[model samples]
Target: MKKYYLRAAFIIAVGLFISGCAGKSDLSLNIINGEKLEENQLLTTKNSIYLVNGGDGMKTTYLSVVYGEEIAEGSGLAAVNIANEQLCAYTAPVVLEKLVITEKEALENAKLNQSDYVIYSRVEKWTDPLGINCTVGYYTDEASVVLSLYSTKDEKLLNTTRLSKSSCPFKINNIPVSTGSAEILYEELFANWKNNMFAKVSK
Candidate 1:
């Protein structure tokens, strides 16, 4: 009788554990604030822009508790790279280079090159919901990035913009049963963000 009671208690404990785990919400990215750049606020072709990768807040495992596995693996860096590429494609007649050196070194380089502006960007959050709806699997990816623009001439912060984007459902239908990758979703999101940022530039 005692053994039977103990077994029942164990089963109840297991059930409770499972329930707790299931009830917990997975960590996801949320945009706090976002703004669009005005024509007067846009960077001009005469200005040079320096790209700096501030890196996401996930170089350590402890952050994983709040950021989850997807963000802790440095996927944010990939998003930064994508944003840099998109910026280069859209912004014409402007000098842009990815900063490979330290912040101080980059600043020195910018001054030497007579750069008008230095843009520093960092990924804040990234989330991918690999969901399925009948015939298609969707990578509903979301991301937030903070962009800071500094005037190299005055060495003062000109503006700070937080950009966030959520990708539409990417259709996946094939004989090989393939789902979309995170890269595809991030590409779409960053491209949209880049276009929106420089919308007034071309005008």
Candidate 2:
């Protein structure tokens, strides 16, 4: 009787653990349509730009809790910062300012700063895959972002761009142990996105 009770308790605990690990999360995005900016039309010093966080749209199953928070704060902000740095490094040297404001406050801040353009970006997708095999596992991280440039003068949509990248397969000898996979994945994804964006915009 005692042995049977212990076995039942163990099964229940295993079931609960599996259920928790199987949890998933979803992130929705607000998308808008607009013209696409050409590579030669990158911003210049004369054009003042304001950047705002547009949130993240992620649908992930593996490591959702850990990756979701990162998408909320890490991916979107990283892309904007990288873009700003690249803009400053342009031949004409564009000045980009960070505007920590909500969507409602965006237009008002743009008006006050006389910003020619307001750029809003959101993380469209984020995924972290942890393989099932405990000894040798394959992992992959992917991130995608949608960038929109708006005319602050008229509050009209100007241009929109979407960028996405994924890291190569990561082979992990220990599947049960987290090797800071989420951090490494986002870093690589954001860096690749930034470089690709710069290549498209920079002269």
Candidate 3:
């Protein structure tokens, strides 16, 4: 009888753990559009980069009352920071302060800066953690962004990556502490793309 009781408890615990984890994490990344980088094409030392914010506006939805455009702007800033952190190891990347909504604007900006390449990052969606719905149950925080790399010489797009991440917070002393953000997703996306580049070409 004692052995059976212990086994049942173990099964229950495992079930709860799996359910909790499944409910807490939701992440996706897709190449969606654009061609792949050619070997030894964009990784050359002579290629200078312009990192631009391509987000036009923030879609707050449920978070509109509590959070605002600042959240979306923060996401863009996070992307630029991550790109700079990763690309700087190879070459110094120029950070552009202007927000661009189209590829033409981004390419023009890059040309103005005399940059050979362009990194256009746009924040598409944002659902902040502290919304009215969060008070009732575990609220999922979601962020989505599109990253595109381009060649300024011919205004050709090299690659475009779209990624999204959503995670629910585990409580700490009755307070929900979120473990995910736009910054985290951007870091993962850029790091993976950079590694793939290094693998394909000598730089």
Residue 135 error, candidate 2, Å: 14
Off by over 4 Å in 1: 1-38, 57-71, 92-106, 129-140, 167-203
Best by TM-score: 3
User: On a 0 to 100 scale, what is the lDDT of residue 49 in model 2?
Assistant: 69
Q: What is the lDDT of residue 108 in candidate 2?
A: 70
**Which candidate model has the greater lDDT, 1 or 3?**
3
Off by over 4 Å in 3: 1-23, 42-46, 56-74, 98-102, 130-139, 170-178, 197-203
Give per-residue CA lDDT, model 2, range 1-203, as digits (tens).
99999999999998777555542222222234654346664445556667777765554554544654333345556556666665555433333445345655776777787777777766676555554331112234455677777778888776566655444332333333333233444455445533443334434
In model 1, the clashing pairs are none
Q: What local lDDT does model 1 show for residue 65?
A: 55
Order of quality (lDDT): 3, 2, 1
Q: What TM-score does prediction 3 earn?
A: 0.67
For residues 1-203, what per-residue lDDT tens digits would candidate 1 score against the true structure? 99999999999998776544331122222333433457676665444567776665332222345765444356556766776677666664334444334556656766887776776666665654443321221233445666666667777665566655544342323122334334565576556545544535544
Best candidate, lDDT: 3
State the lDDT at 19 in candidate 3: 57
| TM per candidate | 0.54, 0.52, 0.67
Give lDDT for model 3. 0.65
Cα lDDT tens digits for candidate 3, 21-119: 443555666777776666655466446888887753354545456764444556666666677777777665565655545778888878888898887
